[model samples]
Target: MNVEFINPFLVSLVNVISTMATMDLKPGKPQLKNHDIAKGDVSGLIGMVGPKTKGSLSITFEAPLILEIMHKMLGEKPSSINEEITDLVGEITNMVTGGAKNLLSDKGYDFDMATPVVVSGKNHTISHKSKGKKILMPFSHEHGMAFIEICFEDI
Candidate 1:
């Protein structure tokens, strides 16, 4: 995976979470992911396709972290995963992907993003469409942890 591909997502994640949820996230080291099982309780996945490349990006959040984010964003935090929480996950995925898309576009990479899909469970699976290498970036906030996974390849 190209190292250049990872920066935009990191920048976007920090920007989106800071602006919308008013929370500061400390990013941990990014590593190559070897499994399909999600690291968090909830995940939002979206695909990106372009003339030159195709890929997927997923954001997964632990229950406590997501609940805190929901509280900050909507002023009401649910006790557990629900429709509204899932919707917020989708929205956050969309925004972060959109922001990264724009940054990549500036570098001459054009892409069309599919609607984000949200999934929640104790140990859910995340199936990224692309066969590219999956890079996992973990982030920690005051409440708990979240993860961002990216997989991209030339098609």
Candidate 2:
């Protein structure tokens, strides 16, 4: 994957979390992921297909971070990962994907996005649409850590 493709998602993640959750995020170095196991407790995955590219984007959040997000966004401190938390993850994924899609579209990379899917478990697995290597971008906030993974290829 071209490194250029990663920027929009990065920007979007920061933007969405900052604007919606009112959280300050510092992104860590991105790395190539070699496995399907998720790095966090819950994840939101979505697929995109375009004329020039096709791939998937996922956002995974640790329990502490997500609970903090829930408190900030909904004014409720959830003790664990529940349906509401999962739904929030899905919505965050959707917002981030939408933001990135707009940025990429401005660069002439228009695509259709699938509905986001939320998965939660101790060590859940993510199946990206593309077979390419996943790029894992980790972010840190005052509460905890989160991750964003992007896997795509020019089709």
Find the candidate with the highest lDDT and give its number: 1
Each prediction's Cα lDDT score?
A: 0.88, 0.86
For residue 25, what is the lDDT in candidate 1?
A: 94
lDDT of 2: 0.86
Return the TM-score for candidate 1, rounded to 2 decimals: 0.93
Which tens-of-lDDT digit does each residue in 1-155 have in candidate 2? 55677888999899988888799889988888877645678999898888877888889888899999889988889899999999999999999999988988887778999999898996566666576778988899878888899987877
Candidate 2: where is the Cα deviation over 4 Å?
36-38, 127-129
Residue 84 lDDT in candidate 1: 93
Q: Each candidate's root-mean-square deviation in Å?
A: 1.5, 1.7
**How do the residues 1-155 of candidate 1 rate in per-residue lDDT, one tens digit apiece?**
66677888988998999998899999988888887755689999998889988888999999999999989988998999999999989999999999999998898878999999998997666766667888888899879888899998888
Q: What's the TM for model 2?
A: 0.91
lDDT of 1: 0.88
